[model samples]
Target chain A: MKKLINQPEDAVKEELEGVAAAHGDRLRVHTAPNYIVRADAPVHGKVALVSGGGSGHEPMHGGFVGLGMLDAACPGEVFTSPTPDQVLEAAKAVNGGAGVLLIVKNYSGDVMNFEMAAELAEDEGIEVEQVVIDDDVAVKDSLYTAGRRGVGATVLAEKICGAAAEQRWPLPDVAGLCRKVNANARSMGVALTSCTVPTAGKPTFELADDEIELGIGIHGEPGRERRKLAPAHAIVETLATAVVKDLPFGRGDEVLAFVNGMGGTPLMELYVVYNELHTLLEGWGIAIGRNLIGSYMTSLDMAGCSITLLRLDDELTAFWDAPVNTTGLRWGV
Target chain B: MRDTVTQGGLTAWLRAFAAAVARDREELTDLDAAIGDADHGSNMDRGMQAVVGKLGGLSPDEAGVGVGALLKTVGMTLVSTVGGAAGPLYGSLFLDMGKAAGEDAELTVAQWATAVEAGVRGVQARGKAELGDKTMIDALAPAAEALSAAAACGLSLADALRRTAEAAAQGMKATTPLVARKGRASYLGERSAGHQDPGATSSWLLMQAAAEALASDAPPDRPRT
Candidate 1:
């Protein structure tokens, strides 16, 4: 309720304008059917990578749009999935001669919209392949639920697949790499406070001061369960254990450890949580070959953090180390 | 006993639907908050508002315009404005309905039934959801079936629509005891039960609006509330 914004309705549009202004050198913001595409798009023979979701999770699909990352990102309203038309436009804009790869999260809206876009693109004679990430371990895949929600691993998949596409990998190969990354990665999150959506004008959910919600989705949806607030170490242990156990990440397995802040959490706390995660993984004899620690994925000012672990091999580790230039992530440029 | 639904009646149905969605906006959001993210009400309202605005631009006696064109406009508006699973699902529904209605200025009761059935099938195909999945299809499928059956039984247009709305309401209420098998609420597993599906509830409201707007004595230009 108490946030800096001109109006509730203009929040997404205004923020996009700022993103375009700030990162104009690297990306182009297309309006009408809002989407952000890399400035140097249609990289001549390279396959294009497109991913998108709701608006509140800044630096995700949008911020990641640039070199060695996403080619385009279509953002929807806050906490809402982008429509198929937006996705179709993005695909059309970014598709190179090789094809287009859609790195979609496994949410129902994202899946359906991307599916429709793919169909539309195919109708227009554009080749398209899609990979759905459902790496969150918190939500159990069952008949009652839609399946596991995609979480932090989405960022990892984007980076890895982007690198593959940059190397001129075919659409199917890049998509296959993305699927592998999603399969090997597992993530879990715990929220200390609920976020207030701009239009909703209130907290998404009320949590007692002494409580924390575990296994939360990035949209501020309630987690698997609420429990008494605990120290940072205990929280990290809970999240790490869930992810590791779900993947059955065993001793001596090389992995990429990602400790992501959920927007509102401070770097001080993120590092503290990462420190605990390192210790826990070391205790389990899992070798951390590579690591990323920051607010790569977020839930719009929610105070929480998520832990992700991707079992790594020579190929994935090589792709992870490739040059990348994007607003949200930049290294080896 | 009206036998056919005119373009004017279709326009009125959309207006009534918009008004109903605006009236129940908060309720839909509350229902969504219980299982899915809380945006269904606001998202649908925003889409319908855009649809009504577009409808206002059409000439009063646009004889060339037909039900198909009007419904296609509504579908495009909803797809662009509503930014969720419901957007694409509902958008596909109306788009397929428009296709089924073709260029006819008016549709007989059987033709209306066919269009409604096509819309429901479009949602099913788009969402890949089945009956009892606790989605909008929970209400839409039954209503479409009932409408088709009523039409086959030689019921009047108003009577068939009334039966369709009643079936939708029943299906909406039926969603309470069922667990979700698709969409965001499916993440909640067993917790998704006990709460009525927000999409189904909205579907029911839309059917109710159809029944009201397509009644035999309904005014073509009922003033917006």
Candidate 2:
């Protein structure tokens, strides 16, 4: 329950205000329906890219909204999916003459809300295409459950698709690229300590000091299993093995390796994870062509990390290297 | 015993549901915490409060739009305010119900049965959750079936609604031992069993609210605790 906030109920709104203030030069924060769009939106001929989910995953949909990243992000309440109206408003705000692409995570709420928004947008005569990201390997069976929850791979898809859209790729082409990224990537996470949602006023789950939850999603949902806490190498091995084998990534395959911190984890630890992942992938004959090591996608103040590997080819690599400017991610600007 | 549900009665049903949600917010959160992220209670309560607030602020012309329009507005309000899986599911329910009810100012028992069935079907269509998927559909589908059956037998409005509430309550109880196959709880797989579904629990409350508000001659301004 102890954290920096004026009130639990006002947490999302206040944080959005802070984001608007800090990144006003690059993005514009809209309220009443609450969506963030690039400052100079409706970039004329370019297709717009929109993605969003619950509020706690910072620098995600919202922070990615600028330049060669997301054109708009609809942030919901903490740990909750944004509504259709918010999504619709965002689409309307950023839709250039080309069209709009919705990059949705594969949670039930996000899927349904985005679906509803797509329908509404179409009704308004706006062309819309949707690509769902369901790259988490934790949920083993799509048949038995609501399918895999989108995790680290969502960040990668957003960046690559944003680059494609920025290059004036058609809406369908950008959406197709997003779908290809989602199809090729796999992710898994391990949580050391439980996160406390501000409104809940307590830890999401009680993880014993000696135990860790494996295969966790970003929303603090219980994962595959809890086991005795192990060494960093063991944890990385577990995550990396799950991710690699799920895709069955093998020899001669090139990949974009992403080691993301789960909010509370430090950069130093993430690098440690990256170090282990690099050696492991090398041993497996998987070439790490490009790598991103940071807290780009995160759960709120959760002490954990996730690894995502997207099989890469020339097209994806070029898009990944495209010039971009955003508050959370920047490189070849 | 009311034979028809007036626009005022439908409003009272929503208000009663809102009050019940506010009262049991913590319990819903506890249920969700067992298998999913613990926000169902707070999210539902917030959405219900917004629906009530919107009702309070309706202009005279807006209020005069009849029961179906009012329900559609309520559905839209819930969709916008309630973030999570519950938002779209519940919003679809009310929206479908409103569509079924048409522009009628009041509805007979058979019409109410049709509306409930339509609402439940909308939920199924939106979530793609079938029976036994361990979702709100568990409670909602059965309640819709029971109401339809009661209407077929020419039962009174009160009697049909009472049966609907009982069916929903029984469905809620049944979820305690089943493994969830939808929503976040499904991520827990077998571990998700033994916890009553928070969405089903809230849906039962929704049916019970209808029993108390729409089926009785209760005043619109006075929703029961």
Top model number, TM-score: 2
Q: Please give the distance, in angstroms, between residue B86's alpha carbon in candidate 2 and its true position after superposition.
A: 0.6
What DockQ does predicted model 2 obtain?
Answer: 0.80
* Chain B TM for prediction 2: 0.96
Provide the clashing-pair count of each candidate structure. Answer: 2, 0
User: What's the TM-score of each model vs. the native?
Assistant: 0.95, 0.97
- Model 1 C-alpha lDDT versus the unseen true structure: 0.89
Measured by DockQ, the strongest candidate is: 2
- lDDT, candidates in the order shown: 0.89, 0.91
How many residue pairs clash in model 2?
0
Candidate 2, after superposition: displacement of residue B3 in Å? 0.7
What lDDT does candidate 1 reach at residue A39?
Answer: 96
Interface Cα RMSD for all candidates? 1.5, 0.8
Looking at model 1, the pairs that clash are: A145-B186, A146-B186
DockQ of each: 0.69, 0.80
**Per-residue accuracy of model 2 over A95-134 as CA lDDT, tens digit each:** 9889999999999999999999999999999999999899
The candidate that achieves the highest lDDT relative to the unseen native structure: 2
